[model samples]
Structure formats: C-alpha cells, structure tokens
Target: DGGGVRGLSSLLILENLMHRLSPEKDILPCNVFRLIGGTSTGGIIAIMLGRLGMSVKDCITAYHSLSRDIFDGPWRPKAWQTSKKVLGLTGDAELRSRRLEEAICHIIARYLPAEEKSALFGEEEIDPCKTPICRVFVVATQQSNGRRVILRNYPIPYEASRDMTIVEACLATSAAPFVFAPLTAGPEGCRETYIDGGLGNNNPVAIVLQESRLLWPRQSVKSLVSIGTGARVPTEVKQNLMSLAKKVAEMIVDAANEARDFESNIRLTEPSIHSVYFRLDVAESMARIGLAEWRMLGAIAQRTRSWIFENHDLLNRCVVTLGGILLNCLCITLRYLSKC
Candidate 1:
C-alpha cells in the first residue's frame, strides 16, 4: 500500500495477458468484464479503462508517458511563467498535485471523443449513458465519517454538490500522504477531504463483486481476478509515522486476504486467480526512485508472466476434461441403442 509506482503492476499483468491472447493492437478482451474498481495507481488505470473506454494497449502507452511526470516532478513552473504560481511561490506541493491531476484529466480527455467529454465533465456526475463501459468506480475514503467512498459515475448525495468533477474524484483516490495533498470534494465548510482509499480498502474486489450480485443475483460471479504489488516485512522498526505505516501495511494485507476469502466462500464458483507480490518492496525504500520503479516493474512482469502461463494451462486442462466427458457420454448412449 506504499504510494509508489509499483501499483501499476496490476495493470501490467492484465496487459500481458491481453497481449498473449490476441496479437491485435487496439482490440482487447477486457470488455467481457462489466465493472472495474481500483485504488491509488490502480484507480487511475480503472478510470482510463472503465471510464474512458480506451483499449488496453493505449492505456498502457498512456500510463508509460505519464509515469515520468507522476514519479519525477512534472508540475515545475517555468521561471518566466509567474501566472502558474501563487504570489511568486513555486514548487508548492498542492500546486504540483493540481498540475498532475490536470495532466491526468488531459490524458483521459484525449482518449474520449469531443462530444463525450462535454457530457462527462460538464455535469456534476458522469452521464453513465454516454460512457462506453457500464460502471466504473474509484475508491476514496470520506475524511469526516471514515467511510470508504466509492466514486462512481452516479450522482453524489443530496446534501453534497452535484458538481464533483471527475478530475477531483480521481485525484482524491490516488493522493498518497506526504506525496500528494489530501483533496476536498463538495462545498467549503461542508466539504470532505479524502486520502488514499488504499488505507480503507486497498484491493477493491468487493466493489466489483457487489455490482455483479446486483446485476445477476441468482448467478455466481464467473471469475474475480486481483493483482497487487509485493509486500515486504519491515527489516528494522522505526518510531512514529514510519512505524505506523508498517502496521498499516500489515493491516491492509490481512484485510485484503480476508476480503478475498469472504468472496470465495459466498460465491457459487471460486475466483480463478489472485496474485499478490510479497517479495517485492516498493514502500520500504524512497531514495533511488528511478531504480526502484524499474526493478519493481521488472519483477512484476516476470512474476505475471508465470501466472499467465499457469492460467493458460489450467484453461487448457478444463477444455480437455470437458471434451472427454462429452465423448464418453456419446459413446455410452450409442452402445445402449445398439444393444436395444
């Protein structure tokens, strides 16, 4: 749950599978899945895929382009550009956060048609009818109630303003403390500030499952897949915030596991794949940021590749078993008829 680029690994794994399954560039099989939910970096990916309806390949490329801006500093104002700053102040954390949010919104806008953007952004809530994907949710916590806020295309509650922008929602979900400032939604005085939803619900499998149940109450979810960056145990204990962060990490892992098990127990059919990388550590080290991104992403690709192979094998075995059962049933019926 450490706020780093490692979370992108989830998308990488999904992209790898799509690449192997089809050689086609712009077409992907993700349309089979109805609802999409994510937190932090994953939340950004979800907005791109589930909200904007961009192909997986395009999403991957767009993320790659934004990664440098996100990880490095992309919001630095040019020395001559005084208007970009507040009272000649530059390098402010909040300003940079806003810039990054704008960059992301720009990326989201680029993928959508001109007609769609006006409808999607012009309103307080996205017009779900205009979106190519049915439902998209990005998790963010309500600062006041400590409620896990699932930001959807749907309208906000009656008390809150109807004009909660898409850019604001995503920035709130992805904002990591110390890295980015907490974001506010709704009007001043009554506005709620939100932090990273990962603190409340890191893996958003439950949201997707809840939607599925609503859509098809009598049927079980056919498959539920989750991808996570690897977790690492604290090597040496530190006091205060660092110590709290470690404890929170442990809590997140436990909660995520419990959520996964809970889903499995209730579902008529079990999920096929749930991958968590416990070996990789992105949160532990803050320095050498560039190197960390490379190593973590490299490990994710290698590990995800193995998962892809294993799942492919499992699918093949299922096909063979079904074929054999069908053949045996046909042969038995033919012999009984001949004897009669």
Candidate 2:
C-alpha cells in the first residue's frame, strides 16, 4: 500500500521482520522472497528491495533521503493556481515531477552495474528472464482506459510487452494524481499516460495473488506477506453534499479498509493458506497524520515500534515460518547444483 510519506510505516514493519529473521546479520528479502509487488509509494519500496536488492535498513535510509529530496519544496499551490489547475486551464502540479524522476534515477544508478549505467532510461530491461535473482513489479493505472497495468521485472505470457526501462516503470508507478504530472510512456504512436495505481489498487494484495498464480500455475503459494501503511479511523457516511465530497476525497487518498477486506477474503476463501498469510499494520494514532506529512517521521517510527512490541508473538511466528522457507530454498538450490 502507498500513503505518500506514510510508507515509512511499511518499511518499519519490514525492518522488524528482517531483524527477527536474522538478528545477528543482515538478510536481504530479495534472497528469500520469489516475487514482490507494490503500488505508488509501495512501488518505490518494491524497487528498492526487490529490484535493487537493498537490505531493509538501507532501504529505510534511502527512502528517508529521497522523500526529503522529492518533497522538499512547497507542495501546495496558491488558491487561484489550484483553481485554474483543477478547471483544466493549467496542467502544472504543485510539486516538481523532475525532482521525483531524478531521485529515482540516482538510486537506480547507485545499484546498477557499471556496464548497464548508460542504459538507465533506455533499453535496459528488468525482468526474471534477464535477472532471475528476484522478480519485481510496480502497479500503475493507465489514464486512457482506466485499467491496471503491471510494470514487471518479469514477463507474463499474453500480457503487454515489457519493453519499458526501469526508470520509466518507476516514474509511471509513482505518478500520484494532482501531486505530480502523469507520465506518458511507450514506443512512438503507442504511448499511454499513467497515474498512481492507488486509484483502485491502493492495497495490491489481490494483484500479488493474481500475478503469483499466473507465474506459478501448478505450485501452491507457501507464504504471502501483506504489509500496510498503518490504519485510519473509519468515517461515517453523511447525506450532505459537502460530507459526500469529503468522503469521496478520503477514499481516493487512502484505502486502508480495503487491505482488511482483502485479508478477510483470503482467510475465508483459502483456509489452508491462511496460516501462512500475514498482514502487518499499525493500529492506532495514524489517522491523525496526513499522507504527505514528511515531518512526522519520528511519530511514525514510534508508533510502528510500539505496534511491533504489542504484536511480538505474531511476528515471531511469521519469522519462524519464513526462516523455514528460506532453508528449504537453500536445500533445493544445493540439490540442483549437485545434479549439475
């Protein structure tokens, strides 16, 4: 899930899990998880961990740095400017999209190999067919058709061709509505504009499940972890027009309840996999924070820590199960090497 700067909560939760998995040393999630998918800010997290192969701690640090850089300037436009932009008289955004693109490019450059440096925004591909270490994808909503598109680092048969560069994929997925301009990408004469995937897929648990089934049709999923960016206070629906507008805006901004609904569906429909499915989300004090409140990092961290302490038992079980999965993967790889 993506909640602008609130994504810090997701990172904090993953950090706790990584610590529990390997207390003495750093264990990269890319080595343990087969596929990782995310949307909007969560998409950024997916790239940092799955595509760049960063440790959770390092990813947290990098997230802090880039968020500061991307959201450093004034984020709200003047009343007149906002009115004009909203009325379609202007296309300017309050925040500079270039800042976001540059920050993402810098991070990608730091991790990419020297030989692939020149292909940062060109023909460089990010797919399991090319780099089998970990499969990663970011979700985006196509503006023209209002359909969900997966910018994958792995190929899926019969899906749209995976010809976009890593930088383009990151840009498309992170293009939040109104906050940043939508990205127009693809080959000439076939371009499509893309906005944030959070419009309908703020919680991408369903996408992850569907994509996993497509990737491994015969194999049953062993573990599925759905991390969320803290929960929000539920709002009551009102009959007044102003209240209805407010409610609609809130729904567009954050889809906290959707995450819970998806979890419930998983448990009800697939009872057998329920034991292996883990959903970690902080439960209190997050509703007061705004999505773009970057200065509230301290409060976010504190809340996440408290939540972790409170749910120690649940986290421990998740860690133990993940550890077992890692061990099994190691054994399978060793057996294949022996056969070779």
Candidate 3:
C-alpha cells in the first residue's frame, strides 16, 4: 500500500470497502479499529480518517484535488527555484525545503482555514493532545542515524513544537528521499532529518500490532485487515538500460522488490488477516490523477467484494486463524505485477 502514487489505489479500494461495511454511508466508525498506523500516503489517509474524523468521500475528494498539483503545482519539485537560488542554496539541493513548504501549504489548505494557516505554521506552539484523534501513528525515518521514528503521542520540546505542524510532520513522513527533500523536524537542536516512513515500514501493519499490544496488553487482537496495491514485482528483467532508463529501472526495481517483500512477509506471518490488493490495470492508474483513476478505484472496490465472498472463513475466524496460522509460512503471492 506504499508505492508512491500507487498507494492512492489502495485508499480508493478502502473507501469502497468502508462503504460496503455500512452500505448506506461511507463513514467508518471509530470502534472499527483499535489503532491505525500508516506510512506516506497511507499516513495521510489515516490522519484524516482517524484524527480529523473526515468521511471517506471527503478524503477521496481532497486527494483527487491534490493529485494534479502534486507534479506541477506550487508544491511540485523545483517549484521554489527562485527562493533556493536567492538563498544561495541552488539546484535540487534546496528543492526539499521548497517542496516542504509547498506540501505544508497544501496540507494547511486541506485541514485549516486560510486565517489559521499562519498561526498553525507560525511560531506559536500547539498541543498535540488538543487534536481530535490520538489513536493514530505515523511512521517516519530518522535520516542522521536511520531510526524508525513513530510519530504518535510523544513529548515534544517547545522549539520542535514551534517548527513542526501536524501537516509538516505528515509531509515529513511522506517525503521520499531524493524524490522529495528530507525534513528537519524534532527539537531545533536535533539535526536528524526525517524521510519517508516507507524506507522502514511500508506495510506498517506491524506498527498497529505492536502498539495495540502495548496499549491494551490484556485484550487479544479482535480482527486484523490490510489493503495493499498488490505489491507485485515483474518476473522479467530488461537486459538493456540506455541512459535515463537505467536510473528509472533501478528505482522501479527497488520499489517492486520492497513491495514484494512486504506483501510476502505479511501473508506468511498473518494469513488470517484479510488482505486486499488491487491487481488490475495498476500501471495505467499509477501516474493518473482524475476521474478515470477514480473509476479504476471503483473497479478495485468491487473486486474486494468478490474476494470476500470467496474467502468467507478468512474474515469470520480472523482471530482464531491468526493464532493457528502463526506458524504457517505460506506466502500469498500476488497474481499481477505492477509497473510501479
């Protein structure tokens, strides 16, 4: 579920599944989940759903609106060229900070009023507890030492609070190294830059499992479900790489490999967990950002219903299955290979 833009496909499928649960409306009640953890785009959806209490439709609308601007809007990479050059930190070196500001603005626009933007991103420190949602964890990576920074109900110093807004923190977690600038969050004195949480935990289901155990030690996990973007890798490798194609191939290989591993490991250890992965027409929908993509999401959503019908026992006996399947190392391989 953590393949850059491809992750949106998973979110779309999730929206549909939520609708199926209620059938009448898109709202997923808070009781449905004990805790939620996400990486990158997954984190964005989790925050809106868990913290902001936005409906599935609201989340979908917001993401669709931002899709176009992601590559060409003010927050687009290198969009802050002038600022970077004037600051004497020219080239792509300063693109991270520039894109960071743009991402912050985009988030502020999504969650806050125009008047509140300045105050939210300003010097005044706001308490995290005041936020509506607290049972959410955003996984991020610490650049200096490559630590997995789980952003949840942690203590923050005055300076860190001043510099980091919830939007900024989420953006920091979503910032893919090299693709987007690494973020300098935490206390002002702390030099560790935070990057995409995907570097460490793309599936992030483990975060939910581990944190749930810590928070409610006595309660056994009731049900566990995960939705992914298939996370399939191509079996064929092109022997020839010419110029830019080589770099692109490398990036592709890295993502496909990571995604494959994530799905494979989850299936082996957690078979009872109902996992839905979008496998049809993934490549066509990956870079797209429009109604067409939305339709594709709808298609994937329908497929989930079919999957559920086919695997009734998996959902009904999720808890029992989890216990029994603990030692089952069968890797549920994906049927389709995505071009991500």
What would you estimate as the lDDT of candidate 3? 0.52
Worst 10 residues of 1 by lDDT: 275-284
**Which residue pairs show backbone clashes in model 2?**
127-153
Q: Which residue pairs show collisions in model 3? A: 96-181
Output candidate 3 Cα RMSD: 11.1
Q: By TM-score, who's the top model here?
A: 2
TM-score of candidate 2 to 2 decimals: 0.88
Which structure among the candidates has the greatest lDDT?
2
RMSD of 2: 3.3
lDDT by residue for model 3 (8-51), tens: 56566555445545566444523245466678767766766665
Better of 1 and 3 by lDDT: 1
Ranking by TM-score: 2, 1, 3
Q: Tell me the tens digit of each residue's lDDT in model 2 across 27-105.
A: 8888778889899889989988987888888888988887788767555544554344445442444245777788777
- In candidate 3, how many Å is residue 10 off? 1.7
Which scores higher on lDDT, 1 or 2? 2
Q: What TM-score would each prediction reach against the true structure?
A: 0.67, 0.88, 0.62
User: Candidate 3: where is the Cα deviation over 4 Å?
Assistant: 29-31, 73-134, 154-164, 235-340
Q: Write the per-residue lDDT of candidate 1 for residues 1-340, one digit (tens) a residue.
A: 2235655555665665445444455333235345667786677777777777777767767766566565553334433332332233334546647766877878867876776542222235443333333456677777677788777654433433234566776788876544457888776777778977777577777666675665457764344555555444334555655455544444543334545465555554443322211112222223222211433555555555565565675434333433333344346446655655
